[model samples]
Target: MRLSSLLFCLCVASFPVMAAGQGLQRSGPMRFLYDMGVSDTDTSDPTMRQQLLQLREAGINVLSLDGWDAAAFQKLLPTLKADPLFSRFKYVLKIHPHVSSNWAANPTQVCSDAANGVLPADTAQLLDGVAAFGKQNADYVVGYYTFDEPSNKGVNNGTTICWQYQQLVYQRLRSGDPDSTDRPVITANTLYPVAPEDIKNSVSPNAQDIVFVDQYSTDPAVQATEYKDWGNMLKKVVPVFPAFSNNITTCQDPMLRTQFRPAVQSGLNTAYGANQPAVAGIAYFAFYPGRTYAYDAQNCAPIFNSVVDDLQHDPIPVMTKIEPSLNLILSCPASSSTAPASSSTSSEPCQ
Candidate 1:
């Protein structure tokens, strides 16, 4: 744990990581990630385990642990960390204050100090947890999910609050690391409901480090239109951080063959064209095995597993190609959603 400038250059990944000097191109594979239920595979059941192993067999390498008992991680960590192929699997820890609830659980319910225009101590604890976990499991940990789509009602300077809180936790992460452990990456998959202005003014692309967005438009044509719109509006930071866009919950509206083909093709095209710092990948939301976040797959959306299967195949290799260099550039982005400029500062790895 040397506390100096550290730049790791990995040479063998399924995808070819773009050189820092090279701008975004139709580079390697996009990262294949599963926004799982903490233990996407069930904690108690081996079926999820089996599916994950199968995914690894198929070349999948990233998993976003949504919500589940954090305790479950202790048990699976060893197995996940042991597999050489899957060992370096990038993980996102979507944490909950009390467990089992997502940020969107109840907007009316108080979230954290940041939600109320103030910094809360609990935010530090959450960041600390992520940092501690990253240190314990270096190869498997990747990003920290600060908050999932926190803008249903719309708030002024929402990104500012988000940045401030993330910075606090990031400070703590570092403080604990007298050894300067690898900082966890931070990103909040903000819903489009929140204005880009909120994120723009709040995040310091370089300070916040890594970032992700959630744009779920089922209409391929409409979605493609929106991606171009985003590319135009966001500048400065995006081209530097990791950006993730998700599909709107499919259960809300079903996609037809016509709708699906264009949506998939155009959406990818638009993202690729955006030319952000690194469009590491794209992800869908409320992903589950048998059902959708709406809790109804057939109601309107495609089954969770089916969609993942399709998206998973194409991106795995692309990501593999870029893995070598990407693994290092994204190394220490303050996670827990902090922006590294604040009174609420600590050294906990925020990502």
Candidate 2:
């Protein structure tokens, strides 16, 4: 769709109240990491429980249940509510109409149908399910992740299909629960080198609530520049989460190969700019061993153990030390004299 037309759609749509710094303000400063490397249904497994404890001790406050849908999360919610270890951390839950990894080969059918003026029955049902799930679990569910790394390859005529698809998803989700201010729709896009305009066009308040920029470059300069650029570009449009790499292979310093200290530092520096926290929070790419390209082999028990051990001894401690400062910056309202111009309508400080 033409940029102007897309924006027109956004301007006309009836949206829910999106508080400033939505999730960050509501939940406090979040230290997010992805993938539990266990089945969502295995909430009671002794091994999973131990891992959950380890993550909590490591100062990770938010977990992403990426590959799970509303049904799977609903099934696991009981355990999350009952178990103190599980309940300690807030969660980012996934919903359906997901964009496929191999987008070129297998285009998202729903987006295509959407462009053709069709709302497939199954797709509507899935969105309804997500709305119901978000409403029921708002206490622990901080955000609803609907798309990951959507690209422009799936374009119809002049419009990006995924863009239209995301807008539809957002509308359906909001229509289901207009009063909700939490559980904003989220999308995790691929790393930088992508134009800020394109990023804004694809993921913005019009389509999704927040965009998690996944940047895993090992070079500190690249990390710093890309994150700073993202902060500058999206700060006025939508809140962003810097999803930095926690995989050891991406660590530049030999001394910190087993720690994510540098990654954490860079993310915080950019997100917590001198004037205000530009981004919402810092998110680690993957906590599970095989989730990243650096460690692609699945079911490697030894590697998993090594990763858990590294978290316990290294980066977690570093994060724990500075968490208080992080929360202060994240939760405190920006000074009236120093506050940057924001698109958010609410003037209330982030709690």
Candidate 3:
């Protein structure tokens, strides 16, 4: 569907807040996740937690970890695991350097044994180590991202990397005691011309996993093309699996300059993230700076907390104000989960 079509349905989203996401899942609203990786090391910062607390109270339940070491990560875990703000919110952590080799359980552990290599570089061993660590933190773990942006030209290898990472977490997930009611999710970043192997060879999206596609396009037309050619087409092959995604965070360095904000603020991204004919959601570039502007969700400003009120104070308003006209969107239900099933809630947020 074209952006024009989305413009039409935009009115329905603005309807009175009723429970939505019946066929989709969850209803309160899709996540306005501000990437929370910056606070991974700075455990002493009361301000970040305050922002997160604001987010939690506001109904945003998902928090994606941007970049950080497994060790420095530990200092922050207690708060995330215990704090009501983050305790129940979904947490996605990206292992630094390389998703596989770098994020081990030990704080002292580094994925790279040599500056040139990341640990054994053995795909199996690397997957195993990463899986074991994720299992320990499985309670809060929403998914494991193997690589930030893989440089693979071959679709098969591109897909192989995808499956290899899945196997790591899956095996550990089966072996570990469950804490969350959700299934394990894995993601790999691939750019356009995603080879057939990459597309065809990866894990089955139907197997209750997300076929996450991370892109960094800034052009609205290009973003629309991504929805049509990349996201829309992939859904035909794997409908349920290609449901969640993000723009790889659009940004420059740390914080967005006033210039980039106009593009992000434009309805393009809001539309693309909401623009699916079937089932899926889009997360913006990122929350803070220091990474790439391409990852920032709210590109208009660099300091995320000040503007996070959009997600925290008035998420529904933000969703209704700026969004694609699509019908299906996923969110957790009103009832608390006992199964750790990764369930898509049909009810709106806690309210």
lDDT of each: 0.38, 0.45, 0.36
The sequence of per-residue lDDT tens digits that candidate 2 reaches over residues 272-339 is 44433333444444332323221122333333333334333322211212223222212232222211
Q: Which candidate has the highest lDDT of all?
A: 2
Q: After superposition, how far is residue 178 of candidate 1 from its true place, in Å?
A: 12
Q: Where does candidate 2 have its weakest 10-residue lDDT segment? A: 3-12
- Backbone clash tally (model 3): 32
Off by over 4 Å in 3: 1-34, 64-76, 96-139, 151-181, 193-208, 216-220, 231-282, 287-351
Q: Tally clashes: model 2.
A: 1
**On residues 1-351, what C-alpha lDDT tens digit does candidate 3 reach at each position?**
100000001112222222212222222233434344434335344544444444344344455554344554455667656554444454555542444333333212331232223333344444454455556665555454434333244432322334333344444433442322232343444446555566554343432233344434445454445444444333311011111132324432322222222332232334445443332232333432333321223332323432332323223322333222112222212222121212122222242
Task: Report the candidate with higher TM-score, 1 versus 3.
Answer: 1
Candidate 2 global TM-score: 0.57
**For model 3, where is the 10-residue window of minimal lDDT?**
1-10
Candidate 3 Cα deviation (angstroms), residue 277: 7.2
Task: List where candidate 2 sits over 4 angstroms from the true fold.
Answer: 1-28, 37-41, 66-69, 96-118, 152-161, 191-205, 218-220, 224-277, 287-351
Q: Give the alpha carbon lDDT tens digit for every residue of 306-349 in model 1.
A: 33343333333212223342232222221222121111322122
